[model samples]
Target: MKTAMLEREGFAALVLRLRAEGISDLDLLTAVEQTPRSRFVAPHLAEHAYSSRTIPIECGAFMEGADLAVRLIERLRVKPGHRVLEVGTGSGFMTAVLGRLSERVVSIERYRTLVTDAQARLDSFGLRNVILRHGDGAGGLPGEGTFDRIIVTAAFPAMPRAFTEQLVHNGVLLAPIMIDEDRCIMVRLTRTGSRFEREDLFEVPYLPLTPRVAAFL
Candidate 1:
């Protein structure tokens, strides 16, 4: 893949475009501007990093475009003291964004290479509030305890009980549910006592959540 690096000026322009498109959250826009999307994508794909188009990363995973990332964080409404649990780290772009929006982030990725690389990229920016783990994202990281917000990057067949159990009361869980062969819908699942209230966010195609991480040689 032929990749092009986005220059600092280009990135700033991208941020401006996002703002023009009605992404009104100042914190979210600033986070998107400060974080370099190019660092998360392959060199050949770096040119598309800031564009609102999903790009391939290591481990055959896809990084959600900047637009989607912004939307997700805005809907999450992460507060400075909020603790976030991210089910899929992917390129760590989303995790990095979440780290800035919230007080702390615990991100889990099934791919070891992605876990290592994403952590390295995040560390390069000196972001210490984000924790990366190599494990099945379907099973929420329990040792870290309940979270104020949870975001699952991959599509799930349905809302998993494991994730619900790991969310704190009044917490939000955002994930895509597989609805058809070529269709998936993003749903916001909120935990209130023992009941989960579901709201459809939008529709997008995504890779399915797997039972286990693929063997990486």
Candidate 2:
């Protein structure tokens, strides 16, 4: 069994590496340190959970890398008392992070198994600020009302109208825009009242987010 001291040291080392890579968000770094990535992945793959590599779960979609997740969360500019809409709940690692940073998080997932497992993990961590759902994220959660921040974890072929329309004024959206069959670019769009300004942040490869619900066996 890995001792708590060893776990703390490991997390410390990972934070140091992230800091070296120019990640200067103290709150984000602190959240990463507090949340154990091992809790989100299987035991055999726990050793690689903190690394900047995508970890596959039971669902067909893969979890975002630690580096990418940090970058996106930093760009999200989460603040206390802010309601966030997270489009992919995957392993709930990011959801847990969002729970720490925002007032509340509404996360939607297409796969029932991922939702169930991620919900259990989030609940086990005592993060009651998050609401997990099994649904098509492209539709957004209209019943939950507008969000102060929106994050999409997978690549979408076209800009989602629901996401843009559901954003509160001055809200920000960080998502991967699918440019082609194999290419995607990360974009940060901010809604300013009736208009939205788009900025291309970086390039990333992500699993395509579909509108159809998954048929979990």
Candidate 3:
């Protein structure tokens, strides 16, 4: 399918996909439709682009579980002018999505190769709002603390203190939390006063948030 077709037919289908997934934000859905997920994916996965299914891309990475990603970002309450931090810049897919929805996005990746590819791809797409960082995803970002939102794309074994401390009061953290032996659960965290509270959401598998998150703490 051509890029132009995504504007209309693609938008329609994306609306349905989000609706099926319970994404109620209309404007966010529009951004999702316009961003063109197909371009960021492997050429072979292009055909499955708008199906609400995450397909495997280059470098042994799978875009599986992106629909949950969209929902999580929306739940994060990102406004157009919000500054956000993203842990795990894999494929830069979610980073690009956040870039479109927010004014500034600082995304960190532990793997050098993923950082390089994500930077190149996002730059090619003209998403200048996203700043790519080469570092450990687990450490939380060094300078960009007090963000309006911090998104962790990979699942962490537990919530890192650095991550929770970095959030400003009322800032939301959306990430996958590992619950049991092999269960990866998605959760939304809202910082209140001196403490934070979590609301458990769904279940899915993702690359566990790397150990780098807690290296400094």
Candidate 4:
């Protein structure tokens, strides 16, 4: 399907869903619509391109739709010149949405197969700002200077210190952090001086951040 169809087939409604959740930025909305989710999806699952929910891709991983991702991305306050780092690159859908809105995006996926597939799909679209890496996402992130926005899709028992370190002072890191075994909140952390301000935004259930988390701290 052409990208135009995405606009006609409920993309606006999806953007509205994000907006209703406090995502009101025009650039983010445009990126969500302009990025072709289907291109990142496995061919077998292309039929669900417009669904406003998570869809399974390779391995048991799922891509959270535009509604949830845009809402989360909006709160991170990504601007046209911001550099963003994402810990999970499922289907590369969010990365693409982000790629449209930022100066540069570095996405890391623990699953190598997903990483390669997402890289290929992103290449097809000429979305050059998205850079993919295969690694242990829970181990936090390596410094490539600092980012204005850091996003993590998988839930972690706690926020990774490396993530905070990789942020430019006052930058935002959005991640699902656990309060308990079965309870987690997608938090927005703003780096302020030497500490981070934690703001719990919403409840979310996700596969936990990897065991490699301890390796970093």
Candidate 5:
């Protein structure tokens, strides 16, 4: 009982920090608060579930910090009716949050282990709106039809043309673009007619987006 209380208190403190960082959307905050982040991470790393830093997960992937994930989702401007495509569903933590914010979420992960684990966690939460698949997310899922929003968790050398083409009119795509060997900037691209209006949001630290799905692991 004492441990549970401490966990709750820690999470509450994390929520406070997020609010201070300008995450004022009531619904977004509620989703983040309600989702059990600890369940999405490895048992040994549960204590750092609410921390504002990345945690290593299965298949050698890292889950983005809670603060960064929420900020990027905020920039996407997810709506209750929006269909979101999430590339790199590391822990399915963000997938669950996106499920709460949007109508439907199709999340793809490169590693089969990550996909299986994430699907189980999402299912436990009864998030039926999310679909988890094991595939290369480098080029967004174009065959799934157009989406209202697309968020890439990994950093790419350039804006992926396939992702931009998979967005519906006026749809938003948020991704980290590598400006150089060590510099990465998060960019928001909005589809307008036949062109995309790009807005550089902020710098971020993310692993490079790789091609092809993992055959082993």
Candidate 6:
């Protein structure tokens, strides 16, 4: 009983901090509050789940910090009826949040173990709107049909043409692009007829988006 209270307190504190950081969307806050982040992280990292810090997960992947994740989602402008395509599922924490905010979420992860583990967590939380796939995220999911919104968690040297082509008309795609050897910045590309309008967000430190599926581990 005491532990549950502590968890609730931690969530409330986290939400307050996020609010102070400029996250004013009530729906987004509620979704984050409702999702138990501890379940998506390793047992040893449970104490750090509510903090706005990146928690390491299986396959040597790092989950985005809560503050940054929420910020990115806010910029993505997810709507209740929107279908979102999330590349790089990582720990699936963002996938679960996206599932709550959108009509459906299709997330792709390069590592099979991450996909399997994330699926179990989503299932345990009764999140049926998220579909986890084990495959390469470089090309995005072309065959899954066009999505209303697409978000890539990893950094790429440049926006992949395949990803832009996978967006529906006026669809938005947010991804981090490497500016140089040591710097990366998030870019938002919105499909406008035959072209995509680009907007640069803030700099981020995300791992590079690798191609092809992981053959092992």
In terms of TM-score, how similar is model 1 to the real structure?
0.90
Q: Which regions of candidate 6 fall more than 4 Å away from where they truly are?
A: none
Off by over 4 Å in 2: 1-6
Candidate 3 lDDT by residue in tens digits, 1-217: 4655644564576667778877878668766765777667776666566666667765566675446667777788899888899987777777888888999999887767777788887888798889988788686876655788998877778877788878888889988888876788878889999878998978867767655533321
lDDT per residue (tens digit) for residues 1-217 in model 5: 7546646976788778877888788898888877878888777877787788899988889988777878888899999999999999988999999999999999998999999999999888899999998998888996779999999988999998999899999999999999999889999999999988999999988878888999897
Q: What is the C-alpha lDDT of each candidate?
A: 0.82, 0.85, 0.76, 0.78, 0.88, 0.88
lDDT of model number 3: 0.76
Cα displacement (angstroms), candidate 2, residue 91, comes to 0.3
| Candidate 6, run of 10 with poorest lDDT | 1-10
Q: Which pairs clash in model 3?
A: 138-212, 138-213, 139-213, 155-209
lDDT of 4: 0.78
lDDT of 1 at 43: 75
What digit string (tens of lDDT, one per residue) describes model 4 on residues 141-213? 6757889999998887877787888888889999998888888889999988898899989887577876432
Native-to-model Cα distance after best TM-score fit, residue 130 in candidate 6, in Å? 1.2
In model 5, the number of clashes is 0
The superposed Cα distance between candidate 2 and the true structure at residue 98, in angstroms, equals 0.1
Q: Count backbone clashes in candidate 4.
A: 0
Q: Per-residue lDDT for 63 in model 3?
A: 72
Which run of 10 residues does model 3 get worst, by summed lDDT? 208-217
What residue pairs are clashing in model 6?
Answer: none
Model 2 lDDT tens row, 1-217: 5845545766777778777878878888888877888888887877777777888888667777777787789899999999999998888999999999999999998899999999899878899999998888877888778999999988888777888988999999888889889999988999998999999988886768777678762
Winner on lDDT (1 vs 4): 1
Candidate 3 ranges with C-alpha deviation above 4 Å = 1-11, 212-217
Cα error, residue 82 of model 6, in Å, equals: 1.1
Q: TM per model?
A: 0.90, 0.94, 0.87, 0.88, 0.95, 0.95
